[model samples]
Target chain A: MSPVETGRRGAAPDPSFAPEPAGAVPVIVSRDLTVGYKLHRERKRLTALRDISLSVNAGEFVVLVGPSGCGKTTFINAIAGLVQPWEGSIEVNGRPVTGPGPDRAMVFQDYALMPWRTVESNIRMPFELQKLGLSKQEIDARVRRYIDLVDLTGFEKSFPYELSGGMKQRVGIARALVSEPDILLADEPFAAIDAMTREAMQGELERFVAKTGQTVVFITHSIDEAITLGDRVVVISYRPGQIKEVVDVNLPRPRFDYDVKSLPEYSELRDHIWRLVKDEALQTAHGAK
Target chain B: MSTPDLSDGGSISEATDPNRIEDTEWTAGEAWERYGSKVVTVINLTIFFIVWELFARSGAINQLFLPTASNMFLALWDGFTTTAPPGAVISGSIRDHLLYSLTNLSIGLFIACVIGIPAGLLMGGSKYVEKILSPYVWALASLPRIALVPLFILFLGFTVKMQITIIALSAVFPIIINAWAGVKTTDESLLAAARVFGASRAELYVKVVLPFTLPFIISGIQQGIGRGLIGVVIAEIFGGSKGLGYLITRAADTFNSALLYAVLLLLVIVSLTLIQITRSLEAYVAPWRRVDKV
Candidate 1:
């Protein structure tokens, strides 16, 4: 973890370094992906995403920002193997994705923590679901570490309903991270949280993924959130979502600590992304394709 | 500076001290807010009985039709404390009849749950089962259960078996329908989260669907209890040698209105008690839903 940290931080000062480093391996590769849901009542197929292609390198944080119904979730669902592509292929670690495996974990926007289970039990669920070949002691230790990592040490015995929205999402994060998956897919995980707590949680998430060195595919509707959390912000178009642009963010490590929002380049990047998303957002507001 | 330092330390200690969170004594108003309704109910009931006693003493209504509150209470107390002699015809004790009615109800409920839970779960789990069974379930459930009481009596005679069968049939539909709805409406996001965590199909049902449906099934049983009680009385009133229904009929025929009132009061208590028990059971099994319901 420290080696990756040192390497990324050392190269941050150099503006000439490419966002994708030399010899960097791509962990998620999707090419010409088309995916949709069947409208059985209408007897037609509703395309959510069409002919999309993107590649995420190991340990890179990629944020997809788009309007509502832009199929941002569909892209990650395809990567998580929750949904199959009608056309094209999605590969993870040089293999075609088939189904959800132990190597990938997701944090849901609704903090889909089982209400009946305590925080510790929710964190322990992945171990029970898929065999990770870990001993009882090892699983216990990991669960404890994640509980502490997410600042929920005192809340292990509490159920989801007893927790505030932020605390519940912290349990969600802990549960996802406890598996030590190579990739973390988060779908608007902070969208439901209060603004103040959302910022704090965003900073905490950056610290967490920095320590674990997991490649993150995060989706957000907020431009500020995308800029604050992403190394590459991929703007997606409306309706049948396609990649509009992928912008490299050369800001320093840990933007929260750096007060990167106060910088001129940060404002410029925000404006650029806003301009790109403005039309798509208008179209969505008008309920037009 | 020294004064400021002293005050700052005091405030910080006060903020951090866990002992500061001790419970405070309730004021009169707070106590009233907590239990005012119960006090009001007790006073209201006492006044109601007093009015009833006064009205009965006035003798405006026939004693055969209306009994004094005190006389009713006396009848109830006597019926509860004493038992009928062995081998006696038409036992005068409400205790014997109450016990008989309750026993039949429990057995019928047990049978209803045994048949209803699995049938409902299967219908929810498989589309084919739901399609095949829903029509008959709806047809039977919609037809008034009282209509079937006479039919059951004709089939099995005026016996405990007929009464229990009637109760079971009356209770089973609500249980089946509730369980089916519980399974059908299991939260989509919960299912997705389970699947994303690598839960297999069987594991999804066992872990996700079952716990989520437990409270639903309990509430279903609660409704079933009410319906089963109705079935019990109907079956007994139609034709039976023992039960609260028979006692009611016997008292009415003999013009013993106090005993009739006593039986009616007992039925109300029994129904409310059973419903309350099921409610607590639901709250215990699914505490999360309890908060949401409020």
Candidate 2:
């Protein structure tokens, strides 16, 4: 079955589900959040992000775009509770972030699927690691459903090494969605995929999250991808990163089906983000902060 | 303008249909492709033996140093098919010595694994353990295990205990080092993914690190088997009445050149068989790693 048909059927079983009442309630709030890493060898701390404050509403798709070393990944990692903020605060569900919890999950750029695990086992890893209050049958059903949702019904026994780049990322997507986390954090998830498959995957990602109502914080260097997938594109500055601008994308829902790339408004948003990022990108290229 | 219709389910279904595959009769070329290397190896070894047999018959070299291939095979056959007379000091049959050597090697390897696996795991899992144990491990592993044979002989006296100790000591270092490297080099992204998925520290080790290190440990055992074999022969040669090493020494002392050549051939067969078993074990446990070689 096509992903769209599965997504529709999957959403239909739950009548209480509504497309996120975006802008009505903020799920993630960051206030003066400063996060960095300690260089133990140098006895110094490197600030990857500085004094950043942003609020993402429930079910909103926020894309962070910047050059290399721009702390875009640091922001997402902070949300995932993989790293702590050096100053101020970052909160989820109106509570201060402490560490990784069941409410949040992340997709890595490298796919990061366990090489030893089959597709079915990899998607079931979350339940193995934590108590999700799920019965064995429920977990099995959800794993199978998500596998079908990602159109990987027949490849359940295949290992990561047996898969292509796109198929592996589909497994990554399925794994992240299986836990049904409220917030989905992706760090350059499609960076390694080939260009044609990446376009198709971006569309599928939109459809999946739309049906599931996940608040997504996606990181990317591509302005086109930001405009294509994001509700708001956040442009960040180079080393000791700060938010340069947050450009709202007023494009229609299911933008891939709408062929929004041909729209003049889409080009305008893409060009504006490119302009906002150009100086920082150049500075990054020349090794100047 | 005439691109194939990818959206049509007809071609796609047929391509992926498992039943569409049929077994075809093998042609001469196909049969050759499958078994050519094995046939070549048998023929090459047969020619080698024939040449050796001719040279030995020509008497170009001393029979004491180079026995005829037929004489060597005869000795090997007699050693297997018969047993030494009752109360003989040294058994003439190769079977007894081969059995003794193999049993010692197995016990020694088991003891080595028992000590080595935990030591390697502890070093890899804890920074403090690694710092404390690394210097000693490197020092002992770097020293040729042969150098310690005499010391063990002095300490335990030319007994089975001495031979076993030497074998264990020789085998343990490679296992420890390989397990250590495996744990240390586990892919970082896998760890990150596990963490993000709500794995605790202990879970990370159990679910991520241990599985990742298993293939390494197996390969380490493979190396250990080779080293342990060397230790076995050396220890037995130095001071023991029973093993292939002892047989080799006795055969040389009596100038039984055929028996000496037979023992050497037995050693080669034993080593190759053990190595082949480990290789199969490695491939079975970690089929994903085997993909790259093909």
Candidate 3:
């Protein structure tokens, strides 16, 4: 791609990346966001992200898709306050994020659940951390609510080691949601599970958010997953990753378990994303030069 | 260290499959294996005693050198029930000496743990603390403990103080090394999870670090028990006027083979009982340690 082609990528004023026309303020607005790492051992610098700008409107499901080694995780990690941007800024609710806080709760791919804690305690952690001023009864009630919402009610007393990969991620979702954050940041939360479980988790998550209208910025390399769950799919290019394109899904809410993949609209969006991601992967391989 | 969770990362429901009965009752093959093992152990002990008795009776070995099992048992019974013989240097019953040794062992283990565990935790927690203490800990742990018995005796004399110090010194190294290693080896992933969840430094150590380090501490305690047993015997044989160790030396010095054999048997029993207690303690604190055997 030429310099002009690179510039034309997600730089499209695709209105989809704009604040919702209904006057809801964007929950997250990242401007000129660039992040890099200093390889202290090797005495070199590795740039992970280039100047990228995006706006995520309130209650919107924004999924980031990219090739392997594309800075998708880094972009979300910047929001999670796990990584510092080398340049530019990320504003969560009109304020620049300084560090990890309760405003943004992360669901990691590996389901970072404490093996020793019961599912209820793990889900109840956010309140314990922030001391949210809720009464003990209120916290207990809320914890129970989220546990039921994630269909993990019976297993509330079970440890992470006792849960399956899918069950563990469900607990992770409950934990993240119980915090009642403005933005939910998930980093490939379903990547490790088998295909069948992953499909069901995607459906369960969509159903939960359909009622709650929670804002989620999910990062993944799966184009199909991005198309299935996202209202807008943000495609990042290969490393030193820049926004390549943003595609609007325009799919129905709670679209899961059915033959959603066979729909022409779904297939078209999938094909479009598949091609973008394929091109990005090829570019990453060739760009190594 | 505890054996890590052995569940195969399968579906959580599958991992705790309720229908999967963990059978305590042995199957035909297992029952045969179990009984076969017991029979082998009993047979081996019987063979050892028969050979020992025969060896003494055959005149191949002196009776004093290889006292028959009956003579040893009679001496043990007599020692338990009566006072020491008139010619003996120490006049108390065998019970008195056994109690003396036990007291030393307990006191030694207690002092060693009191000093060693905290030192290990500090060294493991802070690089600066480790830098200050590493040289001394390493030098002490590696030095031949037996050589230091002479120094202890010289400083404290042939008293209980020296005996206890020798035993405590012998037990301290394993506790220090293992406790330090246990803390240092706190799973990085667990710590990261704690940090992301906004756990403060104190909570992180209390909730995450200590529980993870418990198994290592337990294993270290087990090792110290063995070392402490050796220390007790060495101290008694070399210097102390009382304890099972003193009796063993007295029997040897006086050429009372039956008493020597009796004391040796008791020592074996005491060592085995100490090891058994430690093994059970290990099981209590870290049930996950035996996941492989299960």
Candidate 4:
């Protein structure tokens, strides 16, 4: 199946395709999360985040948007266990994250696929990580399935460099999804891609997420992308970032199915987010100067 | 940890999977393109030999001192076909000399690889190891390795054993330094990606670090082989050992320009063959590099 048509074909657990209730069990939770880095020069601690708290229900797609260097990345990195919180705790599936775990997968902006490995091997990464006791045939079968899902079946033997930016990120998505992680955290995965490819990927991601119903935490500076894919858009503050507002996107499933920005509600949501972010950006620029 | 397989009974779309893409046109184009380069290379080689032959016959240089190209080939044929004089200590045939020199080269290079690879890996992996070894490596690599010949002659005498030591010592530095550089420069992002995917330290090295370092290590081997060739010639020329280098020395003493030119041609051919072999080996191990140098 083509990537844009992926999640649509899979059977949905809820045929009604309604927005999940707010009281649904949280798949990911962060409590008063704060992170700081030790600036070795003069031995000072530079705090990147301060007392941030948020929770995403199971199967929810949450987008976190802010200006650059606002610790949006820090928050997701903490959620991925790539960065440790100096204060508070972040949990995935009721377990506190100590380090990167198998239950979670992250899609980085750089499309961090191993250059030496082919598309097939990159997809089979999690299978090879810890021996799953599956036979070689079974492993190959699992790999082939995801390759089909990502519409990369024929390009399995191609190296990452051989692929276009959009395709490489598709492999990155396939690699992340192959592990069947409950929580998918992406760090501005589409930011570096060309505008056209970015739009296509956004739609592809929407289909993938809609079908799988996995909880997603996507970080980006694009308000349009935030409204396009997220169930709720979390507007964050400047450095030492805290949540300034969490705006619910009460849009329909498969937002990429139509021109989302053309909707009346979409404009209001976009304007609302821009108003909050514009003030924060102005304050940050003045503060920097 | 095992993930629940997602496609157990899921419907698979029948689409144009590129894995089954026919290679009919691509294979033909690739082969044609490759052969085009090979033809150019052959033409280039022919032009070089033709110029050299014309220069020789033009009397631009004395034929008695500098043999003509045809004369050199004649001497080479004689060296291969003819046997040594009555009661000689070793065979005088060029084939024997070539084989003898190759034995010393192989043994010396093998020893250098055995010691250099581990030392370089440790140096690259640990700062402590690097700190302790860096001084010695810098000094040894900088030192004129041929100068060690006199000291070696005094202690070990003019034997194959001493020659092997010379070749090994000459080759060791490049192998170690190159391996260290290769390991040190392994892509940082790839390492991070591997770690974030739940690879242990050992797994990270095996899966990511080692494959990334192979090309560097091979380049090191290339340099090591070049140095080893120089060491072999130095040992044979100075120590009067039974190799092609020694034969060249005798030819020089007797003013046998044809034999000297012949030996030089043989050396060139052997070095080219070694280089071709290594290039093929490198392309084999790192096919991804063949694509776009990832």
Q: What is the DockQ for all candidates, taken in turn?
A: 0.30, 0.31, 0.19, 0.28
Error of 1 at B262 (Å): 0.6
lDDT of 4 by residue, A1-289 (tens): 1111101122223343555554577777788888978888878988888888887878878899887778888888788787888888888888898988777888888988888789999989877785557898888887888887777867898889888777788788888887788889898988888897687677767766766778899999899999888878888899878889888887765565556678898899899999999988987898789
After the best TM-score superposition of candidate 2, give how far the Cα of residue A142 lies from its true spot, in angstroms. Answer: 0.8
| Interface RMSD of each candidate, angstroms, one decimal | 8.7, 6.1, 8.5, 6.0
Error of 1 at A144 (Å): 1.2
- C-alpha positional error of residue B87 in candidate 1 after TM-score superposition, expressed in Å: 3.5
Cand. 1 Cα-lDDT: 0.86
Per-model fnat list: 0.37, 0.42, 0.13, 0.33
lDDT of candidate 3 over B1-294, digit per residue (tens): 121121221111112333545658778998777688788889999999888888888888888788998888888888889876766675436877898999999999999999889989899999999999999999999998999988988899999999999999999999999999999998875675566666778977887788778888878888998899899999998997889999998888878888899999999999899888988877766654664553
Q: What TM-score goes with each of the models?
A: 0.93, 0.91, 0.81, 0.86
Q: Please give, for residues A154-269, the per-residue lDDT of candidate 2 as tens digits.
A: 88998888878888888898889889999999999999988878887787687667666788999998888888888888889998899888788877767766788998988888
Give the distance in Å from residue A71's predicted Cα in candidate 2 to where it truly belongs.
Answer: 2.3
Ranking by DockQ: 2, 1, 4, 3
Question: Arrange candidates by TM-score, highest first: which order?
Answer: 1, 2, 4, 3
Q: Model 4, B127-159: lDDT tens per residue?
A: 999999999999999999889999999999988
Clash pairs, candidate 3, are A10-A244, A163-B12, A164-B12
Off by over 4 Å in 1: A1-21, B1-21, B292-294
lDDT of 3 at A178: 85
* CAPRI quality band, candidate 2: acceptable
Q: What is candidate 3's lDDT per residue for A46-87, written digit by digit as tens? A: 999998788887777889999888888888878877778788
Model 4: which docking level applies? Answer: acceptable
Candidate 2: pairs in clash: none
